[model samples]
Target chain A: MAELTYRDAVIRGIAQEMTRDPDVVFIGEDIGKAGGVFKATVGLYDQFGPVRVRDTPISEQAILGAAMGAAMTGLKPIAEIMFSDFIAVCFDYIANEFPKSRYMSNGQVKCPLVVRTGNGGGARFGAQHSQSVENWCMMIPGLKVVAPSSPRDVIGLMAAAVRDPDPVIFFEHKSLYATKGEVPDGEIVDTLGSAKIVRPGKDATILALALMVPRALAAAEKLKSEHGIDCEVIDVRSLVPLDTKTILGSLARTHRLFTVEENPRLCGWGAELVSIAADEAFYDLDGPPVRITTPHIPLPAADLLEDIALPSVERIAERVQRSLQS
Target chain B: MAKLEDRAPAPKGSLNDDIGEEKRLALYRTQVVIREAEQRAYDLFLQNLVKGTSHLSLGQEAVAAGFAGAMRPGDLSFCTYRGHAHTLARGVPIVQVLGELMGRDIGLMRGKGGSMHLTSVEHGVMGSYAIIGAHLPIACGAAWRAQYKGAKDVSVCFFGDGTTNIGAFHEALNFAAVWKLPVVFVCENNLYMEYTPISDVTAVKHPAADRAASYGLPRIVIDGNDADVVYRAAIEAYDKARAGGGPSLIECMTYRYSGHSRADPAKYRPEGELERWKERDPIKLYRERLRAFGVGEDAILRIDAEVKREVDEATEQCKAAAPPALDILTTDVYADGGFAWRN
Candidate 1:
């Protein structure tokens, strides 16, 4: 096993896929030599050369369009949108072109490509650069959405996204890039639509995603040690093909649930999870499920305000402890 | 006033001498087939048999024929909602095109795509996008694929004049030019953006041709009503792209006889506009040219009759075809042949 940063995992994941298949190509702004704006794609240009690792102009529409076109014809493309917030500029492709291509063509055309974007907040890139927009993609019918919380999950899920026979939106959190974790040495390929229970417990279940996963884990540890509340932390990695079986199963045993989402409170991905639990595992819950999320407002750039806005470990533990006691 | 027919009259000189007689006849046949098929579709639409909206290429057959004829079998085509002619030009069966419009099981997309999203990958008609200018960059990607694979097949994208104003148009042109990909961007400048005149909204005289210089491409605008002229231009563009000369932008000056979609009656057109375009109708021009080139009247009449009969047969077959099964609704949403997102 090797200790790898989430940023290096992005490079290794892409290099692994490109090396495995000649059809796989990478395209984005400043990805070829500049190594991407966030440097998440560093060393790809040298490893794969110019043809496979392409640098496109500052045109999101063209980047996705070319990726879709290439995917439809033969190539398996991994296009990048510098920031998840910039998805609005090329929403037509995400909302209309890539997702609907297969259904509209009645299976004649397939867009088996990956659109990996730098997502989430805490970098103080302001409102336009730091939104968690995985919900935006998860709502779309034809797309598969996945956000990896750890270095190992990043490499494993990246392989799964490239291999899946559908358009996948890979949300790579910007703040989590510098975080390190142990990744297995050989080729790491995980399955989409599956959730991993990071820390097992018996008191209550807590669900989190991407940047929120680490926070939830910390909160769970705090709840166990300080509050005498043992909470099971589950990383809700894949949003669309959610592992509801695992979530609902956990809720049945614990009889309580809480969701930590980085997206705004309104229409957050947590809302969907809660709704599912209410419908499928209603009688299993002891009380109303709680949702811990960023407030419904533009993420402030100030460090203190941003921290206050996002669900903090203290807030998570306090909420879970108070709710479980009630 | 100069008669519209007199404007851009067939070049007084050689008529595509480089294209052989057999190839010229084939191009003529393709145009005739598109013209006849579109007329039948219009008739069916009037009877409310086609259901939903249909964008007929009533007077813009030559552009589809010329480009499709110039393309190799493996070459790809991406077109707009007004794409029946282009789809047919790529050799998709007439019955399948009609069935797709009729929402029958035998349709190109088995009644899923409807009229605007006609697609037949087997015939190299990649897709027909309804959203304006979305396919331009997509065509660039197809070209990029060919470039990456060291293949010679080119990707030809056809769109209306209004597409020149869309952001994707500029982005795609710049992308293709920068990458030096083998793609041809063809703009059928029919002088209308849906219901409005092209000049009313456009900043230049020729929407696509004027913008070519910005991308380091030569400005080319031709009479789209003349098959020979369009054919020659197509050959040059395809040859250049195939030879790794990068992309070429060609604006074909054509006109549509029908409204933007089936819903409009075309009352917005100025008086005598449709009549004037009809005078220089592509089918009429091609027929006269065929006669002048010593093609026997009997042979030309035989082709016309055969095309009419073929269209009639297709119309009959499509009318009898059933709508797709209910289960088809959930199929093809993913490559796994099922639309289930969760277990």
Candidate 2:
């Protein structure tokens, strides 16, 4: 096993796949020798040269659309869109073009493209860069959306997304780049749409993703120690093929649920979880589901304001307490 | 008396040994077939035999026929919605084309992609997009694949003058140049972008050639109505791109005989413009040139009969063909049986 940061794990996954498969190439703005803005692609330029890991002009539509073409033509291209905020610029390529090709062509083309972008706030990047738009992507039919919280899961999920036969929107949280974890040596593969039970407890189920997963874990720790409540934390690794089985299984045991996210509370990913639980496992619930998420406001830049606007461990713990009591 | 774009496209150049009498005749036949087929489709639409919208390539058949003939097999192309001529030039079966237009089960794309989005991956057509300039980057990506995989094949993208203004056109061109991808950007500058004249919208003297200096590419403004001219330009560009010389943009100054869509009568055209262009119609001009080159009237008449018969049989077959099965709507969302992620 090796201890690496979340960003390093992403590079490892890409480099390993590139080395193994000659057809695999990575393209983005500043991804070549500059090693990417976050340096997630460091050392890959010297390793693969310009053809495989190419730098591109500041064109999101071209990058994503080019990747779609490359994927259809037998190249497994991992295209980085810099930040998830810029996905709006190339929205049609993802929301319209990427998904429609396979369905519209009647199974003639396969779009095996992976789009990687940094998401979530708490870094003071302001409203444009800090937004988490997983809900926007998860709605697409032919595309898969995945957000991994840990180094181990990131490596596994990145590799898996590359190997996937369809389009994958891989969301990497900017705040969790330096977080270290032990990624097992040799091949470590995880299923794309399955959720993992990071913490197993019978008292309550906390469903979270990416930046919110750590906060949920911390809240679970507080609930266990201070409030004498056992909370199961479920990291939603893949949002599209959501691991409803795991979430529902946990709900069956705990009877109480807390959905946490950094996206806007209204029409958020948490709402999807609530709807799923309510529709499938309504009788199993003890009380109404509690949602801990950022309010529908543009993320402010100041540290104090950003902290207040975002989801936190304390708010989640309080929500967990409230959910249990109610 | 003349009107807009009154100047004529250059006459056919001296023939090279590569283009034999047989190939010349074949090219002429393809252009005629395209013109006839497009007219038939329009006629079908009038009769309510064909559903949905169509963007016909009535006067611009030479450009489609010329380049499609020039490209080697397995080389892909991405085109705009006015791609019926391009599809016919790529040699997609007439039955399939008409069946698709008629929304039959046996159509190209299995009737999912109608006149606007006809697809034939086997014949190396990626698809024609309904959105302008959308397929440029896609063609560049395919060219990148050809170069990356050590293949000799190239990719061609056909769009209008209006597409040059879209962000995708600039982005695709820059990417193709930066990567030295083997792609050819063919602009069918048919005088107008829908109803708006090129003079009102475009600022440059030559839309396609003007961007070449920035991208460090070899570009040309050509006589698109001249089949021989387009063929020569397309052949050279294809060879250069395949030889790792990077992309080239060819702007063809032609005119669309019909309106932008089926309903458009093109009343926006200036006085005598339509009449002047009709005097130099591609099919008529090509027929005279073929006779000058010693192809007999009997042979020409036989070719016309063959094309007319092909269109007739295709129309009849399409009229009798079945609609898609009801269960097909439930299928093809995913390759496997997994459901779409509904919110």
Candidate 3:
């Protein structure tokens, strides 16, 4: 195992994939010479040259549309939106274009495309940059949505996303990019729809994603030490083909659920999880599922105000303790 | 003014100098086949045989016929929603094209993609996008691949006059120009973008033709309704792209006889605009030109009758085709499995 940053893991995964497959090409704004604003795609431009590592105009619509086209043909294209918030600019491309072509084309064409974007709150780039919109990718049927919380999950899911036949939205948390973790030395091709129990216990179940995964884990540790609550934390690696079995099993054992997210509580991913658990494992629940999320307001620039806006470790632990008491 | 009989004159001498009677008649045959097939699709739609809405390229056959006719077999082409003519001209089988419109299992795209998304890689028709100018970048990507792989194939993107205003058009044009990719952006100016006239929507005198100069590439503004005119221009652009001279824009001035879809009747068009363009119909003009090139009237009539019969049989073939099974709906959502209905 090697200790690597989440960002470095992403670059390593891309380099290994590009080396393995000639058809895998990268396209985005400033991803070439600029090495990406986050520097995740650094050193790739020199290695792959201009044709494979393309620098595109500042039109996400065109970038994604072209990537969709190239994916339909023969290339396995990895398109990066500089920020996840800019996905709205390519609304038609995502909501209407790349997602529908495969199903709409029946079985004739395959879209082996990966849309990589940096998401999450903590970075304080304000509302435009500090947003987690994985739900947008989930709404589309053919598209796969995956968010990796650690360096290991990043490499595994990145491999799966690149290899997948349909389009996959890889939402990496910008704040977690610097977080160091132990990742396997060689190739790690993890399944997309499988959720992992980062911390397991029996008192309650806490489902978190991306940046929230670490917070949920920290809360779980605190709950065990202070309140004598044995909380199980499951990182939802892939949001689209959700790991229903793991979530249901965890809920059946814990008999309580607290879904955490950085996105607004209204119509967030937590709502979907609640619905899934309610429908499939209704009798297994001890109480109505609780949701701990950021309020439905734009992210503020000030650090203290932003801290108040988003859900914190203490807030998550208190919510779980309250759920257990109730 | 030239006499009405010789209104749609053949090109003076751009690339037409090499086009002999055989190729000229072939071009005429392609236009006839497209026109007949479009009329057949319209008739089917009227009879309630075609499901969903079908956009027929009634009078704009010359643009597709000329463009696709001039393309080499290895070349790739992408087009807009009203693209039956382009796909047909690219040599997609009549039965399969009709199967797509009729929503049958035998469609080129397995009936999933109806009229707006017909694709046949075998015929090099990449796809027909329903969005206005969304597929322009996709076409550029195909051309970029061609350049990357050291292949001689050039990519062509066909869109309407309105697509020029979209940011995708500018982005795609600028990308192709910057990289000098092997591509030909064909703008089929069919007079209107749905209900509004092109004049009301665009600011410039020539909306799409000026894009070439803006992007620092060669431009061709030709009479799109004239098959020979479009054909000559298409040949020049294709030649330039294949020679690594970078991308070029060919704006074909054409008109459509039908409404935007099956819904509108296009009552918004100005007085006598449709009739004036219709008098210089591409098929009529090409047929007269074929006669002047020493082709007998019997040859033109024979080709027309044969095409009419072919379209007639293809319509029945489409109607007879069965819809895909229920299980297929649950399947093929993902190529490399993430989530399937069984899960």
Worst 10 residues of 2 chain B by lDDT: B1-10
Among the numbered candidates, top lDDT falls to: 1
lDDT of 2 by residue, B242-276 (tens): 88999888888788999999878899999999889
Q: Provide DockQ values for all models, in the order shown.
A: 0.85, 0.57, 0.56
Off by over 4 Å in 3: B1-17, B336-342
- lDDT for A211 (candidate 2): 88
Q: For residues A151-263, what per-residue lDDT tens digits would candidate 2 score against the true structure?
A: 99998898888888888999999999989999898876777888999999989999999989999999999999998899999998899777788889999999988889899
lDDT string for model 1 (B265-337, tens) is 8898999989999998998898887777667789788888888899999999998998899999999877898
Runs of candidate 1 with Cα error greater than 4 angstroms are B1-16
Name every residue pair that clashes in candidate 2: none
DockQ score, prediction 3: 0.56
Report, for every candidate in turn, its global Cα lDDT versus the true structure: 0.91, 0.87, 0.85
**Which residue pairs clash within candidate 3?**
none
- TM-score (C-alpha) between model 1 and the true structure: 0.97
lDDT tens per residue, model 3, A1-326: 99999989988889888988999999999999999999898899999998889998898887887788778778899999989999998878788877777677676667789999999888768889888899877877787889999999898899888988778899989999889999888888888899999998998899999999999999999999998999999998898778888999899998898999899877898998899889988999989899999999989978898898889999999888887876
